[model samples]
Target chain A: MSKKELIVREEILGSNKKVAAEIRGKMEAAGVLVVNLLSSPGSGKTTLLERIVETLKPTHPLAVIEGDIETERDADRIRRKGVPAWQITTGGACHLEAKMVGKLLPEIPAETKFLFIENVGNLVCPAGYDLGENLRCVLLSAPEGDDKPKKYPKAFATADCLIITKSDLIPYLPFDLEKAGNEALDLNPRLRIFVTSALKGRGIAELARYFIESRVNMIQHQRHA
Target chain B: MHELSIVASLFEILEAKARENQATKIVRVRLKVGKLAGVVPEFLQTAFDSYKQDTIAAASHLEIEEVPLKVRCRKCTAEIEKEDFVLVCPSCGSTDLEILEGMELLLDKIDLEI
Candidate 1:
């Protein structure tokens, strides 16, 4: 009975990281701006996507990849907007992985400039997985309260953009916008903040403008690189 | 939970490494999980215990080393470390900070019974 120790230092998510990197390369090369959205259940992600499609689809080629535990309902919503949308149901998985997205990459239209991945509704798990997104936007609905950034710091800390959704409910709820925004900004100073009420179209145009500009900048950066 | 997926990935790596090293069974596993790595240690341990039952590492012990979140203030160049994720500089109260480490989710070592 000989006992031996093997010091094998490795990354647990190395395989996923490799696949995500490949997906990023392919999408970037295709001139697509991939956006990964993270939020808790009922955070207005689908509504925001609908608004984004309404705003950007006239000029920009848009598509969606919806990740959920079940159903094609989300994809159907986007399809009703006259855009190509595919659904990846994880069955029981809480997060969407790169391999799942990479396998469906070919389904995206060749002319699409923006590909939005509506990640699984759970905030905690999806924050850990990267789906080869050029931009990661975390949504915090007004009804969800202000302590979300402090409680789930990992989601806000890693996101490139933060969208405060369902602002129409701000008048009814006791949610303090300043507290959440400030805390989120503190966690990630580089975060681009957007306050939006997709139903009322309060900040939808501004968010769409930012996305369009980001896509342009991405293309220019690629050209120069 | 996502911890199950994480543990699955961990076992893949461990099984490959054990096969490479010609180890029949894994005795212990050490993981380095940072404060911001988005992993719950308790859930990870539970998942590890459940997943290792049918594998070669049936009796394996999983050790998790939590790494603190460390950041440097861009305004004052002060280094700070804490388990609580406050990303502001204590001296200057500047939110402009650069992270040094603490985002690690690494499998550091494995002890085997050959």
Candidate 2:
């Protein structure tokens, strides 16, 4: 039989998903709530995270895994917040896969309370790879415009929460907050929306509260089981 | 972009399958790239064009089959094909819907040269 006529029957994502499943199992056992944050470059993901780590310090044992095409700038910023941070540069690749994360497990402590994996600043490829996160948080900044969800529906559809960052710039920019929120909600009806300006300290408390609550809920449910 | 990584993986699979079939080279490979799969066909083509040289698939042709996004409404149990990212059911404006297709990226088949 020719190669073309044979049944390959291979999973497209293949080994990457296998590693992610392993990571998921380990995270569940360690009682860590992993949040994979996806957004485009300059979407304020790093800034929001820096603020989260700074404000939630001692409250949440936060550890961040930063993904970037190049540069340790994000890791440096998060480290300044006094939390353990690991940077995974994809060389020239666009997204972070579970295998790459699996390699960094040695650097991550087992007692991590909340683990945040900031995927490479791309809306597309990151949506396909799961890093065994408890929740997928997708961000859309005001400057990125409202047509994001319409253009990249899968990302919004798979997100557990939709965060609109740089809200302080909304007045200065042509960002349609309602349209962005509605479009995201249309894809994920149950998605929680938060309008935040990390720089201005706006909505940080609410966002922090949600994170803390989610952690507590997960812990309680785990104990009950 | 990220399509290069995907093409690399595809080549790996193609080579393995060809070896298993004891074929000298590949003739054609078919892929199902879903609308929601996040792969740009143009990028994949460009990547494949450049990376296929000197490999078993150097002369192999790539065939991409796009899968439309389909959803089943949890409220009215309606199955509808949606081109847009919105999840509303056409029959009923129910927000609850389950994805049926359009998220898959799979290697469908490969033609081998003996």
Candidate 3:
């Protein structure tokens, strides 16, 4: 056997990108605004989604795709809100791949205007995988500390928006609002920041409005294009 | 860990490459993993060692070269290198930045006993 060095240059997640592109094309053709929410465990992704469902359901149709390591609890929570929800149990995987999401693309409600993908509650793994969403928002709850942006820079750096959740707990916690926001902005200067408290209903309306306006703008932009 | 997931895929590419090259066994595998590639190299090496057993790469040694974060300024068109994620261009201080490097997760080459 001859010893030879062979060059085999290949991108690792190139296949995933193709899958993500297909998903994006399908959602775009359907005129659905897909938003992917990512954060650590107990960052209130489900709570925020539930609130968003209540706010948007009366006017526009919405659907959800929940990703978790196990359990359909999140999907169940969204289902209780009367919106269509699909739960993707990753079994033992750390993140939801585009292939996993693509498998459920046909089941998405046809009349859905907005589709929310609540990514697996992991700050590290989920951020690296693209699920073909129009927007990627990362949540950092006040109780999780203000140092997360620097510690887990990829999540904040790649996020189109940063939501500082649990704002109501600021009085009882040592979380510095400006520090967290500043650190996130340092990693992603163009990130749209929002301080929200689901219990207090603060900033929820503005966020919901932003989503509505974004979908409208996207549709209009596509029309012009 | 996700490294296990990545290593599995790596083996797929390795097997295909080895077959295409008509290699009897893989001796050394070379990879270029960027700092921003979102993979822990140690974990990946460990996973590779675990998965290489009984395969064509059973006797192979995994070699990983880490690439650092590098970006280009959209405003001033300057390239900058950093140890970690930096939002703006250091020279122009422009927030309009484009990533030029440091996101690579490439299987560059492999040494095979053909």
Candidates arranged by lDDT, highest first: 1, 3, 2
lDDT winner among the candidates?
Answer: 1
Q: Report the C-alpha displacement of residue A132, candidate 3, in angstroms.
A: 1.1
Which runs of model 1 end up more than 4 angstroms from their true locations? none
- List, for all models, the DockQ compared with the true complex: 0.78, 0.64, 0.77
Interface RMSD after interface superposition, model 2: 2.4
Per-model B-chain TM-score: 0.90, 0.95, 0.96
Q: Which digits, one per residue and each the tens of the lDDT, describe model 2 over residues A39-96?
A: 9999999999988888787766879999999999999999888899999998888899
For residues B1-114, write the lDDT of model 2, one tens digit per residue: 678888887887888887877899888888888888888888888898899999988998888888999999888998999878778888988988898988888899888888
Worst 10 residues of 1 chain A by lDDT: A1-10
State which candidate, 2 or 3, has the greater TM-score. 3
What is the TM-score of each predicted model, taking all chains together?
0.96, 0.93, 0.95
Each candidate's lDDT (Cα)? 0.92, 0.87, 0.90
Question: Per-residue error at A111 for model 1, in Å?
Answer: 0.4
Candidate number that wins on TM-score, 1 or 2:
1
lDDT of 2: 0.87
For residues A64-85, write the lDDT of model 3, one tens digit per residue. Answer: 9999989999999999999999
Write model 1 residue lDDT over A1-225, tens digit each, in one string: 578877766889989999999998898899999999999999999999999999999999999999999999999999999999999998999999999999988888899999999999998999988888999999999999998998998999999999999999999999999999999987887889999999899899999999889988988999999
User: Which ten contiguous residues of candidate 2 chain B have the minimum total lDDT?
Assistant: B12-21
Task: State the lDDT at B104 in candidate 2.
Answer: 83
